[model samples]
Target: MTALGPLPPTAAVRLVKEAVQDAYADYGSEASRWLDGFTRQGGQVFCGAGCFGCCNMPIRLSLAEALIVRDALNAEKLAAVEAHARQVLANARTAPDEDVYVRRHRLEVGYCPLLDRATGQCSEYESRPTRCRDTFSAFPARYCTEGYWESLSPRDKRQYARDVARTPGTDGELHYIAPLEYLSEPVWEAAAGAMDRAFGLQVWGDFWVLVSLSARPDFMAAVEAGDGRAALKAAQAAGLSHPMILEIE
Candidate 1:
């Protein structure tokens, strides 16, 4: 391969978009293959279409990925995204750090803004962030549910093991989603690298928050302007997201 240096700003932006898209598509394919092989080796994956248990958590995304999500939304959905972003920011104000925000915010806020409460489904499944895409439960759906794991008694744990043993092809132990995570990291790295080159920084954070910011024309302009500092300033000015979440560097 030929050695390469930086491209023009516009070209870099386009490449980042492509990188994220490729990452999304690539993970889907690899996940399917991985699940197939694991299942063939007696692994059971509990992730089904209607299980939105993991949807309540904060999803992190880069500016490019967030923009993809933003473009996928309609006006009403965008409104919901902004509303959810505001809630995240509000809740974040009290929390001293991202860990606190993540732990407390999900329980307080509940359900992703993109989730349809009526049915446990992502409203914008196709355009979901890479983090959301990577979510596959190795444990039971209840594991994803808040307080479910804590509520489980010792007997309940044994019972679950027994049930897994009884179930065909399962080995009475949790399956691993690490392979999927392994696959997801590179995509994000590619996206982050692209964003760094194009936007002069990799601005990323909570999914809804970043998506909401990406929907802003001013924010997008700042990002595309290839000035990282200006983009960071615009992110702070939004006042709808916490710096901890809407990080720019």
Candidate 2:
């Protein structure tokens, strides 16, 4: 309700708690029963603690995810979010051309502004992005480092992404990254990119993540109006080359 900013630690905790409580009222009891059944039915696996590994991965999220994140962020916490954006921009500007892909593969520097460093856990763990909540390790039987892709060569990683995006039959998966190379689905990507352009979060990353973030009301409005492209052209006309608009498919 209050102006969002960099929220204080206590405030962040309170927001997360409130959100989780509301969700519990809606689905918690049923979902918990299901999870219990899943665990009992030989679904239990890794039990590592203090694993910041998964938090660092370039996990894609939906626009709803960004809204949830923004809604959870208190006034004080907004500062941290803004700072993160600034830092990302700075990194992009200074990175050498050849190293551009390499830099992106590296884990985002520093703990997420949303994390509680003292506990080494997400302060909003309960209300964390759905992708984070849903993803599981292929080898849950083994304790694997979560940000495993950080070690991959940029070219190989991009190629793999392309393959996944081009491959068929993954609509049922809870979380999957967009393959950058192949374009199996065009209209979806274009619309998603338009949404990203509307939001001013046009930087290339995970397509789904960008599209999901761009689905914010404001972003959706601009994109649906078909004026987001106009805005881009105007920005370019004003001498801003390479504006941070979404990459259209």
Candidate 3:
């Protein structure tokens, strides 16, 4: 973790914002190429409206990405996101394990905070993080439902097999797709490096928690005063520690 010790608060934020824009632009081009290849190979994409299965699962984002999302929201949406984040953080604090907490949250909540309940679409679709953009399924949308995975108990492998057999649409197999896999190693490495350099730490965590924390006036103030480390620590203290930060290798 390289530290960019004390500078103006907006300096890092500006750098991160610029890096996020550049990275997402590159990611868009790379993702389009992958989709084109999949189509060329006669593969059909099943992701579309009313298919919010993937949204129910946890989505992580870099600090820079989260900041961008925060900047894009209006007052009303930001308030809703804050309320949702409080619930998520409260739930996470009581769970015995982070993974279990997230799984249970998905089962109970069943949608991302950023998702529009009425239309079943992302509110900030244009500025969505790479994690959302990269997610796709080679199988039909029905097979991708969270219920298929969440309903099965860990002890019931046989029951799981039977359930899979009973499920229609899928050919009793799962083939998930991630366009990031097809991106060049150098491209990903550059993106990762850019995030690390901009944020001082190789920070990545749950999108909802990150966005909620980023929307905080105090957190932004701390970061603007050249104390992003303190802002992140405050987030951790507030139960935003799950999906812990990772090293940019």
The best candidate in terms of lDDT: 1
In candidate 2, stretches whose alpha carbon ends up further than 4 angstroms from where it belongs are: 1-34, 47-50, 90-108, 138-226, 230-249
Candidate 2 C-alpha lDDT tens digits along 1-249 = 112332222332233334434543344454455446656766442434454545544444333244446556555665555455444444445556635623453444434667776766777776565445544432232223434556658995776566545433223231232121122233224324443444433333332233232323333343234555653443233222132312322
Positional deviation of residue 156's Cα in model 3 after best superposition, in angstroms: 13
Displacement of the residue 46 alpha carbon in candidate 1, Å: 0.2
TM of each candidate vs. truth: 0.83, 0.48, 0.75
Residues 1-249, candidate 3: write the lDDT tens digits.
Answer: 111112233666777777777877887887787778867877667788767778887666676777778778876667666666666666666778878776777777557777887888988998787677767766567656756765657766566556545443234544455434445343345545665675444555667776776665565565445465677666666545443432121
Q: Single out the weakest 10-residue window by summed lDDT for candidate 1.
A: 1-10
Q: Kindly provide the TM-score of model 1 when superposed on the true structure, using C-alpha atoms.
A: 0.83
Least lDDT summed over 10 consecutive residues: which range in candidate 2? 174-183
List per-candidate RMSD values in Å. 7.2, 10.4, 6.5
Query: Of the candidates numbered 1 and 3, which has the greater lDDT value?
Result: 1
Which is the winner by lDDT between candidate 1 and candidate 2?
1
Top-scoring candidate (TM-score) = 1
